[model samples]
Target: MTDSAASPIDRPSFGIALILVGMLAISINDMLIKQLSGGYPLHQMVFTRSAIGIAFGLVIVQFEGGWQILKTRRPGLHAFRGLLVVIANMSYFAALAVLPLADATALFFAAPLFITLMSIPVLKEKVGPFRLGAVLVGFIGVVIMQRPWASPEDLGVSRLVLVLPVVSAITYAGMQIMTRKLGMSSKPSALAVYIQTMFLLVAGLFWIFAGDGRFAEGTDNESLIFLLRAWVWPEGVDLWLFIGLGFNSAAVAYCLSAAYRSADAAIIAPFEYTGLLLAVFWGWAIWGEIPGLEVKIGIVLIMGSGLFVFLRERQRNRPLASDPPRGTGATRR
Candidate 1:
């Protein structure tokens, strides 16, 4: 009998482990951001984080292929992808300032559904009824999570602020699609460098225009404060925390890239749901906030539907025991 321990199926288990660890690290990053959002401008935080992140990416590039790995033929795609990430980052972090962590995370989980729908048009991938139904169910979960019928959750924040995470999800999905498309020919480290550079540029521009003076007004609006806050010098502890986030950012970028590269996306995608559990834990532990029963139900629905989509795709890809032909799956169309 063959040694199952070394079987090909087991290879992806390592990838799954990397992904889980990455998610946990990222959750810690979010927790820190949530804590600091009240005190610092989002752009300043991003500027600090990206400066360190760029250093980290360059180190990896040096070890991977020594600067040559940074070369790419599709600079425009890289720039566009980086811009999407910046938008997603700003939107989600802005929501973090006002929304409960778990709520923001649950709503952001809709990215997979968005990706599924976007792939049809962008990648020209076929989607069957099962996957489509899963996407619809996932969206319903988003609506429930909003709890619009109830009183406003975040100091009666504007509906526009509440919608930020959903916007983040959409842009995040676009970034993921671009990542998949570029994965065909681009180096992952190069992609990281591009995104980090974009963050640096965005952070600089934000500081230039809004770093001081009248743009810093309106601190009274809780929802807008995170964005409009001036670039104050981060205090000692917060300074250290901001510096640490750079390492966190690089770890997240590298681990996520490594995970997807190691396994079929169908196998790795479901692991993204782990972010919900971590979010819940951090929210309760750090802020004494528990998601209401309705939000919990919404989380279950979103996670279940996303898992179903992955499982369904896996089933479609699996070869049947009785089938002899290997290339006849409808999903291939």
Candidate 2:
């Protein structure tokens, strides 16, 4: 018998395998950003990622059908989304520099709460007290994680480092709200393409004026002037830098989008957070980065409460979820 025929379990196995690999890919991509951010400009790093992301988006559009998606016309919300990305990318990248990937990502998990809150004003969707309480509970976890007014949990604090996670939560939450509103008029392919395109354009423009459009200063260090002769472009081997980022990102996009389609939000939604565990492991191994007890405790609380919030929301929305596809990254449409 053929292998496929012999191993009937292989059908579902492929999906499970892809999901696992995708999480790893995303974690590694974040690791790359953290490593590169030490030297590269945040604007330039985002520019390069956006440039690469759009290329990937183009390939996807071609596979799906091209100009049809390109033909979309919602310049206003599209522009607004570009602005939101400025906040998301900068805040998230800045947070990644010091915060463990897991911590930064946990803060991102609060994006759903942001979504729920913004829906009233932007989407005009009314949320009852139950969902509102869930949002509050989720934010309580966020505050616990933030540990404002000082907590016994903090290992050490410069104050700035501790606050970034909370800021990341708010910014990412804003990003989700923007995506959801924009998705109403934008095609998935179109939305992805435009966001990347706009970010690339905006960051590129900023870099041009900031550093004469070269994306590298004299030594290429824009993050600080302290590192003399700091900037250096990739050699032959380093060109693979962008390629590596692109591959991991594409894999993440595919897996995450597919996961949402395959199962319920509560079931698979929490699965994406698996990237955080991998992040913690890799961070310790590669960077010797160890978060404090409070951060570690906060990670548990943030993820646990976030998952609880998702589950609670699912229970409330359960009746409507009859074969309903879970949230793909683009909640806009």
Candidate 3:
């Protein structure tokens, strides 16, 4: 986390590029996780990914400032942030196991909307009419995807299960908020390492207590089947894939942290939607999972709302000739 006080040079274009690259890495990570979720326990996959990610985090932390990076006055905040991320990851991967990739990604995009709402209380930030309207539009998109007004037959059993991704998005928003709070106090590598540590602990506990032996021979629910599935000895190929996924995860985390630190978040944040394009591409390429018409509509509404919010922020924060210094405006930091 870079200090906000020591202003960095404005580089919104470069920050946007970094965010796009990060989202691409994240999409690759999701593809690998979805591929492995078929045969492996979610916990086991998390354990493997986090174990390798911790190694990457260590190298990054060392490069940043060696052991001095570990010195933070806010261990409790880091731990809470770590817990939020662990829960977010669990909920997200669980939904990914059952839903189409594009559909899941669409729901997760609500995180930004959630962040906008959460900021009112958490950061004491004032929300003007434009942002409020964007938030409402975003939730309308969520309801469209949920389709609670539909008949029971149309709703299907998956309707209830699909809520997991929404939960994931909310928790992810909270995690992002916490990241902003701690951004000035901790190193980005330290935050990454903390979350990886929590992942290892959570996954290890799940493996020990919820291993395959505890479940019946057959399970019908896709989400549960993915969650409670027993860990197995990874074959050589799966082992290699797990290793690749860890590095991919590290790249995503570092690039995202760097992007936000480099320029105004409003400028860089819209590019995060690049993940949806990659999600659609990978979903079609790998699984032939084209989103249905209703889902496509929902995706558009959510994305459109998010883009509108970003446009409003950019306008609100635009620099004026009367403004004092280059670093004082919203666009600068």
Best by lDDT: 3
Q: Which pairs of residues collide in candidate 1?
A: none
lDDT of 3 by residue, 28-55 (tens): 9999989998888888888888888889
> Where does candidate 2 stray beyond 4 Å?
1-22, 120-137, 149-158, 179-187, 212-231, 254-267, 318-328, 331-333
Name the 10 consecutive residues with the lowest summed lDDT in model 3.
324-333
lDDT of 2 by residue, 139-222 (tens): 776676676767535534345555555565566566656655543333334556766777777766666566443433454223
lDDT scores in order: 0.74, 0.58, 0.75
Off by over 4 Å in 3: 1-9, 151-157, 181-184, 216-218, 318-333
Instruction: Return the lDDT, model 2, position 295.
Output: 59
The residue-level lDDT of candidate 2 at 214 comes to 42
Report lDDT (Cα) of residue 310, candidate 1: 79
Q: Candidates sorted by lDDT, descending order?
A: 3, 1, 2
What is the C-alpha local distance difference test score of candidate 1?
Answer: 0.74
Model 2: residue 117 alpha-carbon error in angstroms: 3.4
Look at candidate 3 and give me any clashing residue pairs: 1-188
